[model samples]
Target: MSNVEIRPVTPADHSVWLQLWQAYLHFYDTELPAETSALAWQRFLDPTEPTHATLAWRGNQAIGLGQWIFHRSNWTVSHNCYLQDLFVQPDVRCGGVGRQLIEHVLTQARNAGSTNVHWLTQATNHTAMRLYDQMAKRSGFVQYRHAL
Candidate 1:
């Protein structure tokens, strides 16, 4: 945890990012189509897109991934940052990697003049919620989605 560096993704980071990305999806017991994942990678690299990604590295190995987006919000004049995904390698969990990743996103959001940063986690993700509770206030709103 001491030497961990958080940096934005680059073209050469695809392999390691993909590995972490898939691991993240597996952690949620979900799988995305290859094309969907590839498209997301492309969007992360596209400057025109609001999507972005960063990786946490310990020495030469990637230990975590953070992906976020900036978008206009109805409640604020400035754009808001949505931390869409966060994942730390299982072996490195609870070693401050996840916190560091969230901090990285927060810094980036601030730099971009976003009003705030927000994210979602499953109700059962108590371990992560503990960390999140320390870092942010609970909005007390429930999320609902309608699948097409």
Candidate 2:
């Protein structure tokens, strides 16, 4: 939509960012320590940090957020961009906000000379998988994690 704009998050965006961040976590039926969220917000503001964030805005209202990090990959000489989080407002789902936020990250990764941009979503999140399937190919690798 012409009215929608996506931009990097700024320090002044703390309040609005928190709202969207909370909504994102809730959508996944998860919760984090407040301090973890606080640290994430701080990371976005820290120039030296590899973590970055972008927000989708319709006029002055923040409608979505995309958080990503750049890291070295042994498979590639260039860094890989991992899109760690993405969320669109429930009221604004399917209105192209999510797509735009993802595209924003792709552009960022490209500009930063990243070899690829990748992320994982729950297999049950079929709605988002539809969009992702259209945009990128599946890696076909199952994920396994051992929580510390």
The true-versus-predicted C-alpha distance at residue 95 of model 2, in Å, is 1.0
Per-model TM-score on C-alpha atoms = 0.98, 0.98
Output the worst ten-in-a-row residue range by lDDT, candidate 1: 86-95
Identify the runs in model 2 with alpha carbons over 4 angstroms from their true place: none
lDDT of 2 by residue, 56-116 (tens): 9999999999999999999999999999999999888888888999999999999999999
TM-score of 1: 0.98
Number of the top-ranking candidate, with lDDT as the measure = 1
Cα lDDT tens digits, model 1, 1-148, are 7799999999999999999999999989999999999999999999999999999999999999999999999999999999999999988889999999999999999999999999999999998999999999999999999999
